[model samples]
Target chain A: MKRTITLTVNNRPGVLNRITNLFSKRNYNIESITVGHSELEGVSRITCVVNVDNENIIEQITKQLNKQVDVLKVTDISDQAIVSRELALIKVLSTPNTRSEINALIEPFRATIVDIGKDSLVIQLTGESEKIEAFIELIKPYGIKELARTGTTAFLRGTQRTSNSTKNISIV
Target chain B: MLQETAFTKMKADNKPISGSELLLQALEKEQVEVIFGYPGGAVLPLYDKIYDSKILHVLPRHEQGGIHAAEGYARITGKPGVVIVTSGPGATNIVTGLTDAMMDSLPLVVFTGQVATGVIGSDAFQEADILGITTPITKYNYQVRNIEDIPYIVKEAFYIASSGRPGPVLIDIPKDIATAISEPPEEKEINIPGYQPTLQPNYLQIRKLTEAVSSAKKPVILAGAGVLHAKAAAELKQYAEQQQIPVVHTLLGLGGFPAEHDLSLGMAGMHGCYTANMALYEADLLINIGARFDDRLTGNLESFAPNATVAHVDIDPAEIGKNVPTEIPIVADAKEALKQLVAQEGKLPEHKEWLTQLQNWKKEYPYFYDNTSSLKPQKVLEMLFEKTKGEAIVVTDVGQHQMWAAQYYKFSKANRWVTSGGLGTMGFGLPASIGASFADRDACVLAILGDGGFQMSTQELAVIKEFNLPIKIIILNNMALGMVRQWQELFYEGRFSHSKNPVQPSFVKLAEAYDIKGYEINSVEEAETILNEVFSNNEPALLDFRVDPNENVYPMVPAGKGSHEMVGVKP
Candidate 1:
């Protein structure tokens, strides 16, 4: 099973090292992780995707992550209603002959041409992970020159919030 | 001229001092009385401050010895041990001790000096990436980059090291930070958001536990070091007696429950007693209080307590279901949980038939040894226990002798037995006993070792002689690594490899060289008189006993086998 976990941590030196060291030490498989500044000052939110076999392992990983001193809170939003997105840049090998065809193919997916080179066009897309995978498969026929992706970043849907939102903002 | 003017201006209003002095003040504020440390070039600044400070420093010959001594002190006194050393080699030497303390949950605060801040990543002289090396082993670690952060970092280090689920913490201080002069930082409250530990159990969970206890017929309580760490031995004893339940101890939990009690089942693990292991195998309700299900404690998890429902109580939430599938999980301090169970309104059902069955097993398969031929290690341990009246703080190095000591010594009080249970490090006994002796001057401290282990840290004998600590050292010289030899004989078809020691040193002569009293015993008949003389003397002494070389520790559970299928049980 795959789990999506969100963590609020102190924005300090080696905080990322500490979190990743914990994952490697405990033998947890990390699929992807994205870290950025949170809503609070001097605090960061880490959205991570991990693959484990059972619910018990997920619980164990959450508890272990919570043990780090810099980590403020850990929330497993895998089973909850979550709004998630991932940004990807795909450079497709193309010539002037297939440019219109490529533009027409990406129009329905709301992807835009961010860059155009002599023999390639870079398309930037933001959506759920599954949608990005489908887009890559559709454009594979044109030959992908290069690709880069920002791993999944997520939030709970509606009014539900993680425990850190209820904490005082001055703690960080 | 500008530098002098600025210095004078700073000293006029707010007094500024070096980071080393600030660290000393911080340690004094924490009520630290003694420190076990070794000095080097990287830590020269701190050592200069230590020279004028009032704190007493004990220098072991090696860095590893100092840390092990600190661990021993922590185990006996329930206080976090403090250690300081220099960079590179000095810092690397204490890695084993750090891992040992981490695995066994001993509280330790170790400070390691680093190269100058500018040269840290440039591979300058005596530089090591200690923080990266120790991240997995330490509960928490820090590196001081600024001089003003010294006071709070020291305070936080002590707090985190001694708090819930106690373990080792390390702080790496750069040379420039230690030498820099700055105004002392204001005292701040220690606030760590993610580090809060649950100290009290949920009332609903307590109610459920009591209900389970009331309905259990063949209940057993498995205790571990957490009981001792929480100082809840008395509470555990009361609950077990009130419920008429049998209690089995993990290796580190030997002294947490009285071995003389009628409901006591001594030590359940690989080398555990037959009755204790059998009770766990046949238990109907296994109420595990603070013991992690280590693989040695649970042989072949598929067959381990298959008939029982396990209820695990641990302070660390991560340990609850890591190895075994727990039916009831309580994350709280062991002492608090035990008190709640005792105070709950409930009466447990009587288990008369179960008690009888356990008693029969105890009588049928008691721990024994053949005493007709050669001197035996078990016999020597029995004599030591009788001589000390089971009151001494018994520490043993890792090997066959460690198992014998755990088996023969019946501890009736908490915090009286110390051994390297988790990491099983060699050469831990001698220095740890030296550390244990400092806990109380009047209490007798014993270091039981094997020939192979004693030589690993033999340099620590100088510390005993210099301090004149009243420590009794016993070396069971079998001329081989006894545990490995035994395994090779049974599992590897007697190949023996390099297990046998063809050459050895005269340990008694080595003790004499250190200006300590030394005695040697070669026969079983002379063992009693020699042991008597060594124990009665007030001075430190070492005893070398040449025991049988091929004798093996029995009542063994083969790897991947069930506990009930133990070999060497007397019919």
Candidate 2:
């Protein structure tokens, strides 16, 4: 199973390397990682998906991450009600004949046709990770000239926050 | 014109000293009396400043020795050990010590010099990415980019290293940063938003534990290094006595309570006494104070303390329920938790039958050895204790000697027994004893080493000679890696692959080469006389006791087996 661990860290140089290095050295296989600025200034939120066997792996990793000086907070929101998003851009071969059909396929998923060239059309989609995967599968037969993904970034639903002030979850 | 220029420079100096100078001032503020280090190109400026400063710098032959000595000082004195080493190899050399200290929870603040800031990432000559290398091994680490940040970083390093569940902290200072002009920050309270530790445990949990303690008929207390780190030995002993509970300690937690106390059950783990393991297994209530339930302590976790309702008290919240399931968890300092537990009044339950059962086990399976062998290692420890009357502070390197030291040498006082319990690093004893000697000038410090472990850091003999530290190094020469050899004998059909040392040096000559008196004893009679001479004369000496190479530590609970499943030494 894959678990998503969200961390709020000091927005400083080398914080990213410090975190990734821990994953590499400790042999935690990171499936995807996304980093961006958080609502709080001077703090960045990092969401990482790692392939793990059980909750014990998350507990160990979270404890190790919490020990890092640059890391402010670590929470495994995998079991929580979370709103997750991933963005991907796919360029599919088009003959001008298949372009309208591609547009129609993307329209139902709320995706957009951002670019059109004689050889191909570039489709941009932002949605839940599964939705992005489904859209990519729909366009794969048209020939994926190029592809890129933003990885998975997530936050808990509603007003629940993973903040420094929030009581730490017990190390279960 | 020359005088005017000199005066101008002097006036500028009054504004604030260079970063190196401010570092000295910070050390003074931390009241760091000694620093263990070796000089190098990157740290030349810091070294030069140290030369003119009041802080004593003891140069070791190797950087590893410096850090281990620092660890010894920290473990014995209950102070954060300080280390300063140059870049590249200097920084890399201390990795083992850093890892060892981290695993054992020894408090240390290490400062490693880096190449000038301009050449940092370019990988200039003698430059290493120390912060990157030490990230996982240290409790916390920093790279000082600005000279102004030196005071704060150093202060915070000390605070973090010495505070709750102490471990090593490092600051990688580039050369340019050290030479840049900067004033020491005002001595102010440090509040790291991300680093606050829970000092007070939940009182409701304590109340629950007190209720359990009052009703339990068979209760035992297990103490660990946390007791020493929190300086809670007195409180722990008080709680045990008031509750009339038998106290068993982990290896590193030996001295936290008197080994001679009737209620004390010596070291409960692999190579632990039979009675202690039995008590841990059969107890109805197990109170764990400041001890992580390490695999060694809680063998076969599913079956560990099967009959017990466990209440764990530790400072690190992450350690609770980490390895073993606990009915009640209290996150607080050992001293604070023990203090609270002591204050609670409850109807104390007496388990006279349980105590008597443990006594019978102890008497029947007392740690025994036949002195008729060439020179028994256990006999050496016994005589050392008899000669010193168990008054010396004994530090040990890992392997058979370390186990025998824990078993044979009784520590009746706190902070008297120090060893590499977690990492079990070889070659820790000699230099650590040097650090311990520095901590107490009048005390007799013994470094008990296995032949294999002694050779790893024997170069530290120079420190002993230079400082004339009253540290006695005893090498139990079995001519093999005794611990590994024992395992191979039992579990590997006696293949004995590479565990035995094919060739050995004369330890007496090695000690003599360093200008310290040396003795070699192959018999119990010789050991008794030589040990007495060294003790009475108060001279630093190394005694090589050649013991039976085939001897193995018994009352063994093999890895992953429950304490109740001990294989040797019948009760």
Candidate 3:
């Protein structure tokens, strides 16, 4: 069975390497993962999206991490119904005419203009994954100069907060 | 074939496997009956698989207690003990239990879950490098990366654990591998070179040792746990009688020799009889069978049995000269070595005078207890034997009460007594009793534990409750760590160190909580009559006897002191 598992690990060194190694060792192809320091000190959230055979193995994989004293919490946000977003900062080659059209196209996606130059334009967009993908697709026509994108991060649907459980690692 | 998609084709034969599933299959293949575990992140996959498996799993109150039960099971039945745990803290908690089993030379397999491979090097949450931590203590250790290696690693772990000078083997399974899939694991095999445990008896050496026994003027046989584990009791008993020599035992050596026999010296050393210790101090020949010469027994080693020539038999060759020097060392199984010695057809020696000497010592010391107007633990032990008539397999946890049981209880044959002698391990009796009763389901097995030791692993009462196996628990409620307290009083100027943990759990209430039969005896009549009822009923019973607070075990010879220096009383 193909599945993606999201893990919120403490922000610490080697977590990315360890998670990637976990996938590589098991041959779990890591499609993408977004990780960074969260609002909490000494803690980080990691969202790993992978295609794998068993969804239950996430429990096993994360439980192993939970056994690590430093690891605060692990969760699978894969199936949660929520807004998933990725931030992309792309520098596109732009003429004044295309830049105007680019700014117009970026308007609906709520992207921002970070920089402007005679030769290039930089646009930053954050939205649900599908919207971000559409924004990237629209800007691809301008001939991309540089692209840096943070992977998907999500939270549960209307008023269904996952914060309390994460605060005190409840396995059930 | 057109009917099946490429993805389906790949799913049928080729797929990436994780370390977790491999671990689960390996355990399944080992036919592991049960595992005791408390789940955390690193081992979550292993637990997840456990959820799907049919194997029995016990959740212990603590990690150390989990493996202690495993050790007890292994020691009692001669099987490999298996415990599963998460990495880091969970894995580290089990080290003491592993160490205890290692010191006793027991067979145990401990499996710990590790963080994923990629996150291991990084200071990832909950990550601990367990392989580095357990290397010094374990007999063998492995960290598997590939799913194909799981079956092989687990098979070898069990083999290395139970074979030869038995000790613990640890396997660390990374979480990622648990989720990995394999095309069909390879036939598991042990491929490491030169790892065979020695099993054959050395015939020439056995012949020489037998000759020495035949020619000795004052030969005494000393048996230990090896005799019981190897089931060499009958051979040892016949051989001693044939040669007409007395048998002296270590604390662990108790039931390996019949306490009531003419040749039986019960136990020797600190608490041993006046004659047995004195005779051993003067004997011309010492047949050390299966028991290590613990320092507690051999005071001033240079002065111990000064005239005796030693013939040692043990499975571990390293133990032959590890402590007291051996005149002749035969590295072989205790049962096989004894069998070979018996097969040599040697003539019996003349030791009636020596036998008389031990008999005189038996009369002199004769493990005594004052018959008070009220109840005493001695009376309970006496009643336990009389009511059961020495038919029960009696287990004693280490402490003052253990020595008392060794002295008062009579074994018609060997292998019926199981105690943690080498380790002097507390909390050994209860779980061992469970395992022993499991071995002989029809036999009446009783565990004698102190209040201190009972409190340590009393959670095993849950197991007792689940099974209702008719094993009687006799708790000597002294309200202190009796053994350590005795030492503090004798050697530490009586400062009353941490040995005194004054507050005690209500054992009767605890018994009720487990829903087992429970009673308390304050009067001698209550002890004798209630004990008879507990024994006759044959249900699992617990007897909490409030004992004297300041009572000290007699025949106390401080460590490193000679037999002449043994203090039978305070100055």
Candidate 4:
């Protein structure tokens, strides 16, 4: 089973390059990445989801990443009980015949029709990564016009603020 | 509490500390009593605070010397050394020292004053991204945007520097941040999220290593700078003695084993001991500790330790499987893992035949490179050690002189012997000597170098003059890169490649130019006179010795061969 390791990095130029460079050098594939600022000043957190089969290589890369200077810290939220969400807006064709079908799909996902034109509908959804992916898989059969993902944003499940060990999140 | 109150008190007390003041205060809190630096327009604010601060600042003759002194101090003291410089050229001057410290793994923290926050990235005058230039070399780096973050960043720099494989850390403080004032420094954890530093050894793998060593008929221990870096010299000596394993150090690992110990086989490889090379070839198991198998160490890797089953122990995992792949790779600090080996395997049985054979080889090639017609370079080394009883810390610049020092000078202790081993940096000895001498004012730091190497950084004498440091510098004036020439002579048909070149400056006059005492030795008789005069004096002195240019490092095992193929000039 493939598990996504979520990571937060400092938002800065070449940060994505540093992270991707690390993955490429190690021959590991990055599934996705989301960058944004945190509650702290002069700090930006980047959430990266990567794909790796070799645990040893993952552990080694994580150790190497922590050594990079741009990387403020790195945390693998893979084992943590957390909520991971992706913001994606799907503009599926809304012909008069398919409007009911699209509404039914949106109803199950608890998505909203943020915008609607005569021939299309813009639905916004947020939830666990798997749920978002599943929604995309289910809605793909519909005559979809365009799709855009806002990447992923994650948070811990408990009342524990963030973590002292978040220092491990390597930006590079 | 006072810090919080101070933030408000300063606001009301009309004593709002400038960001620069806070920068100095943070340094003071970190116990940074001295910072080697040079002031420029961009860092004027930091210089202003430094003026009022109690911290002593050593203005280097050059910014490079400031960083180098910090490196020397760190290498000898085992503490992270700190240096400060202005941005742009002032900061750029420190790169060589940074790279030197990086290559050697010496701990250092550099503080560079950057342009104000608003002016950053605007291509402001005298402003350059010091962080960008240093990022590749430093173990960690930071640019403080907020004055409040200065203390935290300083704390983190120290933590990161001394932790793991200690190396240099750079802190780029903007003029605004350096001058801004805030609350008292907060207690912050220097954390790298998910950055779990590797610090454990594999017991099962170590057991396999133990078995390999314990069962071997002929075994020797190859120790390296890692043992010195890990401060495991005593343990390494203990383990080598426990197994009665002969210990041969690479040039970098020279002081890993006690030089005076009978088990210590000195350096092995290009300029290695003939006996040590023989023992390495004869060994059934080679237990490598903290030594990277550099090309010089493994002249030809295919023939390196052909009969040996290698058990490698290092702190960096990448080094484990990278070179001369090991039979058992233990990813742990040498000091820590050696303790495990001791616990698992008890003292070893005697190998009378092996010991006798090694002794015979040692006797045959007694590590002498004397061409007694005049003052030999070897005699200068002998006299230096004899006068000091090897009590002084010896730092050498690389060349024909380095091989001689490694062969003749006995290291009574580890970390006491310092040099630019991996990068083979020249002009390192003088500045390193000044730093070493200053670090331990009581001890003599002998900066030994060849004519070629001395010119690389002898301008640092002004640093010694400024500090009134008493480190002695001994120059072996051979007028050529003799080590390189030796290779060219033997391998390249005497057509010197980057070996011998144009006429050089007179070093004795060079020392006199700095108003330091200088001595010139032209014969063997002058060596004893020079030694007596120099050793009796407490002032910084220089000894210029004229030695035969034709002398080559002996017991060389030719490239791609072992001890059996060693060709000594007299042997």
Q: lDDT of all the models against the reference?
A: 0.90, 0.88, 0.74, 0.78
Kindly list the per-residue Cα lDDT of model 3 for residues B1-571, writing each as its tens digit: 1233332344356565456555655666666666777799888767876786666677766777677767766766667778888888899888877777876777888988888887887978777877666654567677777777877888888877876667888888888877777775656457533254446688888778778877887888888777876778899887777777788888767777777887887777788766667777878888888877888777668788888888888877656765677889887788888777777877667667777867776776676666664566777788778888897888888898898787778877655666776667777778767766655668888789999888877888887778777799988887788889989998899988888876777789899999987898787777878877886776898889987767777776678787546776331
Arranged by lDDT with the best first, the candidates are 1, 2, 4, 3
Error of 1 at B240 (Å): 1.2
Query: Per-residue CA lDDT of candidate 4, range B1-571, in tens?
Result: 1133333345455565677766666666666646788888768888876776667787767787788778778887778888888888888988888888887788898988888889999999888877667766777678887777776788888877876677899988887776676655555777755334466799899889877776788888999888887889889878887888889988878777888788877788887888788788888888888887887777777777888888888877656655575788888888889888888854365576787888777777678665647668888888888999988888888888988998899887877887887778777787778777767888888888888878878778888776778788888888788888888999989888888856887777888899988888898788887788888868888888888888888877787774457678253
The model with the greatest TM-score is: 1
For model 2, which pairs clash? none
TM-score of chain B of 2: 0.96
Any idea what lDDT model 1 has?
A: 0.90
Model 3 DockQ (Cα-based): 0.01
Q: What is the lDDT of candidate 2?
A: 0.88
lDDT of 1 by residue, B1-571 (tens): 1122332343355788788877877777677767999999899999998997777799999999999999998998888889999999989999999999999999999999999999989998989999999998999999998998888898999989988899999999999888999975676889887789899998888888888888887889999999999999999999998888899999898998999899998888888999999999998899999888898888888889888878989999889988888888999999999999989999757789999999999888899889888899889999999999999999899999999999999999999888999999999999998888887778888899999999999999999999899899999889999999999999999999999999998888999999998888888678889878878876899999999998999788889998888888773
Relative to the unseen true structure, what is the C-alpha lDDT of residue B252 in candidate 3, on a scale of 0 to 100? Answer: 69
TM-scores of the candidates in the order shown: 0.96, 0.94, 0.71, 0.79
DockQ of each: 0.63, 0.45, 0.01, 0.15
- Fnat per candidate: 0.80, 0.40, 0.00, 0.23
iRMSD of all candidate structures: 1.1, 1.9, 17.5, 4.7
Q: Cα deviation of B61 in candidate 3 (Å)?
A: 1.7
